[model samples]
Target: MQTTPEHDERMAKMTFASVYPHYVSKVERKGRTKEELHAVIFWLTGFDDQALQRLIDEKATFQDFFDQSNLNANAHLITGVICGYRIEEISNPLTQKVRYLDKLVDELAKGRKMEKILRA
Candidate 1:
């Protein structure tokens, strides 16, 4: 998907903490636990619960959040569409990383097994 400068700027400016609760709600409403959400996050971004909480507390933007992460090598295995953009085809590195997390959360909420979600 083509990454527009404006969209990239907007996403980069958006705080992770602002959207975190929505992610929690999405997974929980699907009967998934917050632990499960954290597991997915850990698999994709290598942040444990404590680090994640710290990031949230810091009000880090999407840019800052990914900047501090050691993105999993297997993150490339996350493919498909999210928010109308194909994950593998996104041109912006930061935007792609954000969508990678989004796709992982989506898979978890959709009842995909953890092993598959983590690409294990």
Candidate 2:
């Protein structure tokens, strides 16, 4: 396996809602706005605030949330290192997607202008 078996055990069962607040908190702590965080999320997941809220409200798992939402056509454009793992190189599809969001949020937290985060 290109990634470790533990990677599956690590994130296969994580809930989108469970990790979402941390994303928000991390960016907000960096003096970034919630709207910027939401923008990156929407850019990747194709969910507006309401749909995302519904999924979070229902406590959707990462798999469930992604299975239902349309991944952005441009999400592949987001590529970088996050938490020491290259976003484009993570072999597990789910973890890669999750980390893609993480990278976007990290960029937002670092104040990497929203346009660049959105790949605009």
Candidate 3:
């Protein structure tokens, strides 16, 4: 059977909610905000307003959307989208995870155990 472009487009239009009803309900029960829901949809299938709205109407939650989005397939893109979306939610302004590494080194000079110093 020959597949038409229209058929492909039609299939593409189907949202994750329609494909995974059980997971969608689980996401809604988790109390995910609309922005988070959108982020997940955007992460998964790119941006499609109609599809996204359908998922929202079907009660798609953050976890549901995340689960459907194959983040591993496009890790960098997904990470960028999620981080950009939640940038404001980060309370700490520290740029690095090891912000106090320098301080730890200074303390270690005073005879602190290497394990204890590293853990600080």
Candidate 4:
């Protein structure tokens, strides 16, 4: 999947609140807990339960959400393919960050050990 500027723009406009439930459901359906999902999210974005709830309430766009994040230094360690894009090779920083989150959730759903998934 080639990520054109149009695709990036669409992704940037996506609301965190909109996709959050699907993330929760994806993990939960695979027997992962919401706390585990939260852990993954926290590791990537530094947003806790309260802050996440606030973002959901405000319906923050992905751009706004990531712009406010203190992205983890280890986020660079998140390398792999997500949504058909290789995380490390992605040139768009925000899109890479989004894929990083997706990849983390995928790992969680696959029952990967938390230590490895968080690149600990």
Give all candidates' CA lDDT scores.
0.95, 0.85, 0.38, 0.93
Candidates' TM-scores? 0.98, 0.92, 0.27, 0.97
Ordered list by lDDT, greatest first:
1, 4, 2, 3
- Compute the lDDT of residue 41 as modeled in candidate 3: 41
Steric clash count of candidate 3: 1
lDDT of 1 at 16: 97
Instruction: Report RMSD for candidate 1.
Output: 0.6
Per-residue CA lDDT of candidate 2, range 1-117, in tens? 156778755676788889988988999999998988888888898999999999999998888887877888888998878777887888888888888888889889998988888
Question: Which has the better lDDT: candidate 2, or candidate 4?
Answer: 4
Question: What clash count goes with each model?
Answer: 0, 0, 1, 0
Off by over 4 Å in 2: none
Rank by TM-score, descending?
Answer: 1, 4, 2, 3
* Model 2 score (lDDT): 0.85
**For candidate 1, which ten residues in a row score worst on lDDT?**
41-50
Candidate 4 ranges beyond 4 A from true positions: none
RMSD of each: 0.6, 1.5, 18.6, 0.9
Best lDDT among the predictions, by candidate number = 1
Quote the lDDT for 91 in model 2. 82
Better TM-score candidate (1, 2): 1
